[model samples]
Target: MRRPSLLALTLLFGTSIGLAQTTVETIAEGLEHPWALAFLPDGEALVTERPGRLLRVDPQTGGRTVISGTPSVDDRGQGGLLDIELHPEFADNRLVYLTWAGECDGGNATHLGRGRLDGDRLADFETLFVAEPCVRSMKHYGSRIVFDRDGYLFMTTGDRGERDRAQDLADHNGSVLRLHDDGSIPADNPFMERSDVQPAIFSFGHRNPQGAAIHPDTGALWIHEHGPRGGDEINRPRPGANFGWPETTYGREYWGPEIGPDTLAGTIPPIHHWTPSIAPSGMAFYTGSAFPDWHGDLFIGALAGVHLAHLRLNDGHVIDEERLLTDRGRRIRAVETGPDGGIHLLTDHVNGELLRLAPAAR
Candidate 1:
């Protein structure tokens, strides 16, 4: 039964003192600034509403439906409608992939789409990838959209707030894209025979990479970014690696100072960092078993540290940091894992909620 010490299980999982034994279940609510959620192999769920709607929910009775075509996003600040997925064959290819905020020239960027759901809509929805030199600033749009183990499709761009164009590899914003699940460009990307890069660059400076996971036992491709008021990172991009944002920061400059050189010779630090900033969003890595001591652990989704950032890996580092839902003050935007293993969460305000976390029945 031994397995404690990670700061004594992070101060005994303190978040209202380890959720007073846990139970918080509010599976669905009005949702407005939702942004990303996936799980539909009949379990019913597929939400994403950063003001551009696209739901289907019904996590056992909360009920919902909208979803029609979607796309045409660009909902300003922090941009809209981001990250969602479901096609790892998706029970015979019903597809469904996303990552929004695209308007181009006069504004927004970071796009990538795919469709074929047919009931709540989204039938021929195309538009595969559009992150580029399109800066009108709504904020960095680095997204999240996994799908590897040969299915390809990586995605995550941001650095759109300029910051030296994340060391500019001729564009694709801050990079981490490796397409080819229909969005093309994966002819062995690592800068595809470089003629000055951008052939779906797979790893670049990156500065706003909202979470993206897939390392249940080393499947690789892990991420988490959004520093500034203080560096918040976590990496493993590797494929032509370069992660150094603003030159190699451990973070600074939200009116502060120090930004380049906490370590930079070629760049590639951060296996985990989070100084005063924890605005992380959407992530998962708990292998399931209904939280068998949180299986593999790693759960970020902390909009400015509002909470739910648990960590605790050992071989790959990040050894312990609990913090769940601090009494449900709510801000966690998207975090998934359900097929019954439970642990849904997705609350990013304007009246949003989707929670689930189990083990409270007594």
Candidate 2:
């Protein structure tokens, strides 16, 4: 269904106005809790379902092919197959990377792996990295994989519901890690020289970060994490920086007690934050040409808010915000910029759908 232009809506309802006349189209439907989307070299795309399935979908026809040789996932509450990314040299290496919750010693932990795409199967799939000191909780398995411009792979991990773990540099929980492409610790990592800290850790003290993206112009890694009662945050993690979670949060506990002060002496504050908790999921920077007026804007999927957040940025800072697709009330699980400059979104539901947003026909 085509949505009325933001300009028209503003004129009719006295709401905020936008530049482009937008159209929302359903590209595919009947997907099972689709979590992430990545466009292949060709026009087709790869989609991951929370229940451990990978599908190759044609945007034009909605035809799907179930990819084989995927790793076994825990498939428990908030734990399953998650983010997927193509190798920077995918045209040459045919490698695809994925993150999921897998069975570990104590319980399940987020794992990273990759394999070559050989026809409809993943050939020689291998597990690369697994979060340490696995716990029994089914929540907070943060696992978003992003490759930076320098070809270094970055991964996010949650505190596994163990609030104290965020402050522990010895553990991988509640941290952003940087590593070589082959899952080896990078020599230049902030913690590499310190034997007391995990060598892969780039930054620590995060909650449960689910959204990550590299800035289109600056190439900095930006992430968004969920908070308890409020205080969802968007942060640009720096090397060895501490982002105070339990020790310094704007969110109150579920039981109505304050977690901590909003800012601490040494902790880095978030660039932007949400008070009512949007429960953000996927994120992407708009560099596509289809929406010229939207260039450089950031798009994020909101699970709790059930809308797509359109954030206008100025010089790396969020200047304005607009909520898109609010009428649908679909829990948007992922957001991606299509090769054609359209916006692609994955809805979270038993019978999920892949929707595309583009400039409306004049």
Candidate 3:
């Protein structure tokens, strides 16, 4: 097989790898704290604003139209619209799932909802599940969602400011939950037979997991979580695993004191960790042709670094890392791959922008 020339590759792909013209462009701006983005099969974009509205964007012109039927949100601290995901059979089902913070039993909690998408509205919507003992605090409402190969959903819940709750088996706080698509517990789940453990608990002793994705090759789950002051970690999540937080961590307290042990027994160490806190929010493994050289590499959106960080993976070890779009200085919230084989991102803050990162035009 003949390898295509740079110009030929550029012609084959929409964006060229030329140095003269940069390919990263800001498509939409002035978003109210954009949290997550899900691309439709037809190439349009569905983005969630942390303040509770969902907006759909025309891929051709970047025209944004707000979709109605969003639930009332608390929109406080770190709460509100968190993550949006499409059903595996979205093309035929028109089904989408969302995580949001809302009032539950007179307190705020993370809730999941499902709906069918109509023209510019959500129809036949229903709440799938709501967290129990709705915690009042807005911080640490871990709400990232991912699906396994068997189509089971994994939802991460934070400690809700109660640190000790992370190690408790009865509380759903600080746990990775596994459930069926329709909000039913699976019989084969890790904690299904344990009386003390909730059937929904897949793993325990976690601290605010915000980013999670399944590995393309091994099908293992990869998660990144934020720690207090420092000790941001990238971990390979395992069933019924204990990821020590509040007991063993590499982070210090916000007041400049040590929180606990630097490292302890039985707690899994991170594959990689950041010290000063990149505040990573979104992560993806590149498998697109647009950046062939970036294939199999991990890309993470850095909210505190105000840039996108790429890590080159070699046999499970991060051998190289790079930072891109540093000058733009936006709090990158989410990173996803587009249908056209391009990289897409959502920025945080009121005037957040939707950005597309691709090879520069040749």
Candidate 4:
């Protein structure tokens, strides 16, 4: 095996922030458009390739083994195997959940499923939820999975390029969904009693949310979505709230026309937004002690911007922002905090790389 490359540098924020010496190590390379990552109990990780392969990766050696039993996926456009997550009680149940673009009657839709991890393969894989009214469009499959503190699973769905569907409560597109671990709807779901809405919907009116993470302190779900020309946003989705996609956004059409008012009377406003579009992807809240200054900060992978965004938050509001890996120019796809307190990132490319950011030796 070849030795991994290491780059040592110091990341200095503004004058008030502390300068931290950091070292970036290439853990693995040649990953084919890796999308999401989940670490196992033994420090190995599961990575999902957009083309429908699941790989168990050894971070130390950069070796990978393809795990069998992944569901067939629609790999055209932006659709394919997406997010992977371990069950909250994974140590006991060994259950793994996944979100992917699966074939449907009309075209394809984002689907959620789970199976027990049985050595190198998944056993008894089952589909739990499918975003309804699947359409032909392959863009905007906003699929990210996270589990709340109480053990309920939360998943996001893009509008599939149909902006109107986001405003329709009957459609599953462009919404955050909540479900029990077994794929059943919870009784306290915001739309349970509403005959006109999808009962699993927790929030709606989102465009294309590709990143989601739970707040380290509040345990609230935080998600970010793409905008057309500008207006990418980070929002803390609330039950029964409308996020206002086409009807209300700070973005303009690709051809240069305003979508709508940035705010409306009834929709929930974003806590933070970006104009000119960073094209944010996977997200994580830094709770590790390796980088004390980054603890409690939010990290977002930026695809279009080609960097990792570090956001300092105060009471749910973003106060400062910094960009990491800007010199590397990699299209960051996923961001995760390793068990050892290092930050792990997956770059998006045909021959992508898995990189880790840790404190440099003094």
What are the TM-scores, per candidate, against the unseen true structure? Answer: 0.35, 0.95, 0.92, 0.97
Residue 108 lDDT in model 2? 81
Best by TM-score: 4
Residue-level lDDT of model 3, residues 204-315, one tens digit each, is 7888888888877877788888888888888887788888887988888889999888777998778888888888888888877887766777889998989888787888
Worst 10 residues of 3 by lDDT: 2-11
Q: Can you write out model 4's per-residue Cα lDDT over 54-113, one digit (the tens) per residue?
A: 999898788899999889999899999999999999999999999999999969999999
Residue lDDT tens for model 1, 1-362: 21121111111244322444655677777789897899887887888888789888887776788989978888878888888897889778798988888887776788989998988798999988787777888888888889988889898988878788877899888878888888989777877887987788888898888888889888998988898877889898989889889888788898888877778888889988888897898889977686687787889888877888888888899877878767667789878888888788888998898877766545
Q: How many times do residue backbones clash in model 3? A: 1
Model 2 stretches with alpha carbons more than 4 Å out: 1-19
Off by over 4 Å in 4: 1-16
lDDT of 2 at 306: 95
TM-score of 4: 0.97
lDDT (0 to 1) per candidate: 0.82, 0.89, 0.82, 0.91
RMSD of 2: 3.3
lDDT (Cα, 0-100) at 21 in candidate 1: 61
Residue 186 Cα positional deviation in candidate 1, in Å, after optimal superposition: 29
